[model samples]
Target: MDKSSYAGSPADKRLRRILDSNVGLCREDAIWALDYIRKKVADGAPAMQGLPQPRLMKNYQSFAEAAMSLLLSQRSGPMEAERLRKMLREALHGLIPD
Candidate 1:
């Protein structure tokens, strides 16, 4: 819930903006993901390696957007549900040290 911790990356700032403007389950999920990432960072999870920061953040943004869209959709079949899960996993993985 602390915005300061998320101020380091453009994608983080964008996500904070989205969280500030939205009022629903997607916002809640973002909050939870942010908290989880923060905790992971605090617990000394290794920073992401290999990928450039911008590229990693961009990927996270895309996955997050897809996941949010799926979450907001009222009608999702099993495949769509699985895709959402994958997006969320990828997004979280990318966000840990952003």
Candidate 2:
């Protein structure tokens, strides 16, 4: 994949950081979600509105699981992609906690 295709822009990184902090998705999943959410924003739907509301349940485990699965399902050969998959796997194994 092109670096730009998966690489987060500055804004994407910022948003990803927030997701990592609050939603607690690992970097791999969080960044993927950043890309996904950015695409959603471009398609006229922001993932999060600034409305203050009660916290709803978020499934960080599933998010990370799905993101890693998607990455692996791509059958990528790049070292970075493989490295990222390992990182996500580690995170899923509780290497990194929210």
Candidate 3:
């Protein structure tokens, strides 16, 4: 991710600060990751245009968004954690488009 692009974005600053200051819940991480993506999704740099998934131009975006949703939904208890673990495993082994 380009630091310069997000440098001016207040949303990005808030999210980054949150990540840096504390270890919040998975939902918070998801929110942070989402803000990160929102900050960069509009960048029209040539390298980003070449990517297979432009929104995923930064691999962290895909990883974080997926992780956040899965983690948040399974926050109820151990059973949910186990279920999410399985889902996360399957996701890791799943296909990525070219």
| Total backbone collisions for each predicted model | 0, 0, 0
lDDT (0 to 1) per candidate: 0.54, 0.41, 0.42
The TM-score ranking, best first, is 1, 3, 2
TM-score of 2: 0.23
Ordering by lDDT: 1, 3, 2
Q: Global CA lDDT of candidate 2, please? A: 0.41
Total backbone collisions, model 1 = 0
The number of the candidate with the highest TM-score is 1
Worst lDDT window (10 residues) for model 3?
89-98
The reply for model 2, stretches above 4 Å from the true place, is 1-24, 46-98
TM-scores, each model vs. reference: 0.39, 0.23, 0.34
Q: Which should have the higher TM-score, number 2 or number 3?
A: 3
Better of 1 and 2 by lDDT: 1
Off by over 4 Å in 3: 1-8, 21-23, 26-29, 35-39, 42-68, 76-98
Question: Superposing all C-alpha atoms, what RMSD in Å does each candidate have to the true structure?
Answer: 10.7, 13.2, 9.5
Error of 3 at 17 (Å): 2.3
